[model samples]
Target: MSDSRGAAMSDGRTATKGLAFHRLSAPSVLALARGEGGGAAVEELLTAERSRRLLLVRALADSLGEGDPPHPAGTAPMAHRAAWTLLARTQQRAPRVFENILMSPQTGMWLSLALRRLRGATAYEDAPLWVVAGHLSALAAAVGARAGLDFSLTVPVRHGRVPLPTLGCAVFADAAEPWGTAQVDAREGRLRITAGRETVTAGPEWSRSAPGWHAVRRLELEPTGPGKVLLLDELDPYRTFPHPSPPRLLSADEARTWQELLTGAWEILRRDEPQSTEAMRVGLMSLAPTPARERYRPHSVTAGDAFGGVMASRPDDVAQLAATLVHEFQHTKLGGLIHLGPLSEPSAPPGAPEQLFYAPWRDDPRPLGGLLQGIYAFAGVARFWSVHRHAADAAYAPMAHFEFALWRAQVSSTVDLVHRHDRLTALGRRLLGTLRERCEEWMAEPVPPAELALAQEVAADHRARWRAHHLRPPAAAVQDAVEAWRRGDARPPAALAAPPELAPVADTRYLDTAAVLARYRLGAPAADPSDIEGVTAADLLLARGDLSGAREAFVTQLAGKETASDAWAGLGRALAGATEHRDASRLLRHHPERARAVQSALEHATGRGADPVELATWLGLGPGETDLD
Candidate 1:
């Protein structure tokens, strides 16, 4: 066991030696990243180069203050072997540089000279590069000593709210039960670490204490022997730390609803594997600990998983809670399959948001901005698909069919984009295609004859209810889009052709921003091909006192899709008292024809001898339409 002063001297020597190794590793990595020379580049070059530098640094640090040239005994032998393997691999890959620089002692001398030159300068040449090198050297020393890998593991420890990478000397030390520790003191604007048992206490950094939980910064870890300890350290002022705030405690009835939600979802998971499912449930219960825990907070689920794992946050309210759990749980499953490696790697591309794969059950209206809302819609589609696969037959009740259709249509449109689709490899693409085929089968296949009749009856009831419900303009747009599809006109399916005229300002200004409200027709819950919104040519025709022209516009709009319900309604009204009354009657009877307001307006206009002024009054037409002159 070395004393603190002796250890510091040895650490200094190790740092000097490691820096020499780093200099040699740096230029090659720089050259490679810059593409200075070789055309025979492999994709793994960066990783390989990094591994090589780390290995060589480990070697020099390990070799220092050692017995023999070859180094002796235990983990050192393993470290030597690993370094040798890396050297051999590097030589084989880039022999010219390996021979000229890495294999020669002269290269070390050259690097040392370069370091002396930099040391004399007023300004640092490359801060992060040097910092990473110094920190990594210290880190490797500590980690090597602790892990017995002869390599560093540097974890940033907080000091008075500032974190600094502390150099661990064990990364270079050769002894039984090697250990390393580094102290960081931000209040003094410096770091101090003492080896062995030495009491060094610093002041507090940050604190967060609630009723049942406490989070204190300045976590400290004292090395017992080899492994590291978990201790509080100083917290940062500039860095924002989000603490979980407690929610209102659930009442008995609310708790019961949560329980039912959890139970129902668990039944599905239990069907797959009961033991594992129960284990997860137990784990989740442990994380929350009590009913007042905030569920939506970050790391709440992760923290819970550490204990046992909870299936849902509290599990209150069967429909809402189960929907939420199923959505997130689907992510856990499909994310693994798609991520194809570690959970750290995202299932989708770099820019993709988490919500893209995990839609929430609480159906809050989207964030105010329509573009932001649109972005969420994109993610919602993927989330819905993941949740949909686990949904029960009866689960399709209460807008379930609509939800499924929304997800389906999004997948179709998104897969058509080359960038998004190209991210899918051939096999992934094939798998997605197969999934689509399966979905189509489910949607188109007739239920058994008994169920078929029952489904038709249900569909009829649903239609009547839907019609009886006040059709908000967006809802009418969705219905019109659906009817347009039935009539064989579906284009741009739920896409805005151009950014709307007042898109930027109006989108954010009004509570009921026309663009965002209209966006719902083209998004999740009503992603039908015909669900177009935003003012169109039909509005123009109806304004011009040209019912004949408006009817033509309605026919054109419905020719490809039933996107505009307002347009459809206008057309119906225009023809109601005309020579084309028969044609108008047929259109008025069409599914999702006109709103009650529009229908009333049509009756009034017909009774008033097709007067434009009277029709405009009934239709809630603006001053622009009435030609007030």
Candidate 2:
């Protein structure tokens, strides 16, 4: 085995010292093996026995902030000190009891505690942290093992709070490995063995973090039988690379779209630029984890271009995925050139919040203008796909609508690019004009066979517009035309290359619903229930005290959803306040949405004014008993 005796000291701390993962002293190890401290310690720590655990936790947090490893588990090379720094702060907020469990038993009993806490706690801090740590530890341990460092390591302290998990600082050598690796049994979970890699996962059984605003808990590894094992876990080369597989909770269709987009991107890479894929992937892998958040579906991202592996809350169909793949892949390849120098500058655009958005190009010498170019380039790519010929018809309008929305909202940023690259921007305008013209011409004579052709034209124009926007001396006419079009100009010449078919772009019902669900996960305000085309949002309103509007909206939204349990529950709640006993009783009679709601309503009614027998009969509750919280 390759010795990583000093690999864990990347930022100064040694493995055998105060760090989390060092080898235990002979006495402690013996105590652990003899059961004097192992099981009892595990139970005690997992259950939060005393204040000492909190101090150890605070120390662990401090250590993590200092970038110290939990034990001997992590030996992977850290490319930067940021992970260590961030881990330090993250640990300080983590539950100390959970930290002890990992340090003591090195098992995943902390996960059970986390799950219990998650079920009861309302705050992100109250959620378990070890589960998250355990997962990361699995990743690190896996990486270390692949490096030929077969050191026994303790389980991680899991975390995924509003605060996030703490990471340790450890460096591992021997990163390369074989496709099918070896395996080992560890305290936290099974270690999938590979040449230079170790994968420790508890399947979805330990995925206890609450769904928060802008993030979802997706199950990547399938669950096994009752004992908790992950299944069908193939190691992707991408996974081993430093590039993160950002947390993506995709529906089956979105997953398929992602696959297709990657497939198409691969084709593009292989055909047009053989080295592009390797370069792009390598660059991505080398990206610091913090910047990587902006690159994809990051757990802590606030805002940036939705590029790389980042999935948006919007519905991503096959076409949208295809477009995004092409767009982002181009950006990834182009990122090297655009983010580098000559156009770089120190200033952000007037309205833009991030400096990265306004820099001219990666190569710009000035700081401000450089980064702005990168943003423009990516936005341009997304815009191009918005009008692709295949994407023109109403069948995909939601995608177009979203693209257009982003484009329109971002035009102010274009002015910044226009000041820098006028000529390129002008050509883009000319192309956009042609695209709009074609869309108009096609619309005058709509036909199904020409659908793909129209989409292609739209895509070409989309590309042209942004490319022009970035060019020196951007075409003034195109900008004017774009502005005019935004004002509801009917002239297709400003937005399309030809006459276009006047058809609905997409059926947004399912996508909207999915987006709504996504919003719920991310902790964002959902669309007004009444505004949602197909779903009932009325009960949601009544629950929030908007009684008058909720009643009206409910009447419209819940018309056909009377059978929905949630709908019925809302109606029951709403009806309970009505002065008319008959109306209230009638709504309450909707067969026990869940046996419990019926019984609860009966008790609540008895406390209010209704006689117990009458309310019980109305609720269909048996006369013998009642339950209430």
lDDT of 2 at 219: 24
Candidate 2: residue 260 Cα off by (Å) = 5.5
The segments of candidate 1 whose C-alpha lies over 4 angstroms from its true place after superposition are 1-253, 268-320, 334-420, 425-431, 447-629
lDDT of 1: 0.30
| Candidate 2 ranges with C-alpha deviation above 4 Å | 1-139, 147-149, 159-314, 326-343, 347-374, 379-629
Q: Rate the local accuracy (lDDT) of all candidates.
A: 0.30, 0.31
Cand. 2 Cα-lDDT: 0.31
Per-model tally of clashing residue pairs: 30, 126
Q: What would the per-residue lDDT of candidate 1 be over residues 1-629, giving only the tens digit for each residue?
A: 01111111121234543342112133322222221212122212222233343344444445432431222224333433443444444445555534333311112221232233234433222222222123322322222222222221222211211122111111112222322223322233222322233323222211332222123221111122222112111111111111212122345475454444445544554453333243233212111213432211111122101111122345322333433433333232222122221212233566664322211211122221211222222333333333443464553442334444443444333333221343444434444454445445445533334333333322322222233222322434434433433344533123211111111112221111121222232223344322233335654454345767867776666444223334444445456456435433333323232233333333344432223222223222221222321
lDDT of 2 by residue, 360-383 (tens): 111112233333333434444433
Poorest 10 consecutive residues by lDDT, candidate 1: 1-10
